[model samples]
Target: MTTTYRVTLRNRNGVPLDVAEDEPIYAAALRAGIQLPIACNYGGCITCAAKLITGHVRQPKGTALNRRQSQAGFILLCVARPTCDCVLDVGVESHRGLYQNPFAIAGNRYPPDA
Candidate 1:
């Protein structure tokens, strides 16, 4: 048997959307008709960054956030998969100034050549 978790995302307007733990939070939100701010869908941008108010999540290693940011409860919704019941504060104002272009990195650019 598999256990599924619930995710609650609170937008800037204080609106909350319920999501599932299986898929990426951003995709879940889109299915629910919630438009979450996102630039690169592959964890290359911080546009979809959110703070975990409560609960845990499993994110890809390529997420733009550093160790400190991850430990501080920051998560990129584009790559975040809930591990347990979660509550997230979306559209974090503090993160608005922390944008970094993933493509700017010399070797980390997307669409790697075959």
Candidate 2:
């Protein structure tokens, strides 16, 4: 059987979600009728970014985030796959300067300082 992990979206009034280990969070959200901001499905943009508050995830293809930013708990929902139950602050993509996004802190560059 496919393992499914539960994820709670903090911004969704604590709404919970069940996602498969192989499926990305964005896809799962869409399936659940939750519309989250999205841009490039290739994980090359921060359009679907979120902050991983709890649990762990793996985003091998999420290259839009620098090492420091990623280490700070940032996640690209479009590519991130949950490894366990987690909580996330979604809808942060529009808050450009609110969080430590690459363009907001590291300047406007593709590969920002890590």
Pick the TM-score winner. 2
* Residues 11-92 of candidate 2: C-alpha lDDT, one tens digit per residue: 8888999999999999999999999989998799888888888999998778887666676678899999999999998995
Judging by lDDT against the true structure, name the best candidate. 2
For residues 65-102, write the lDDT of model 1, one tens digit per residue.
Answer: 87656666779899888888888888756463244465
**Each model's C-alpha lDDT?**
0.72, 0.83
Backbone clashes per model, in order? 0, 0
Off by over 4 Å in 2: 93-114
**TM-score of structure candidate 2:** 0.81
The C-alpha local distance difference test score for the whole of candidate 2 amounts to: 0.83
- Over 4 Å off, model 1: 11-18, 92-114
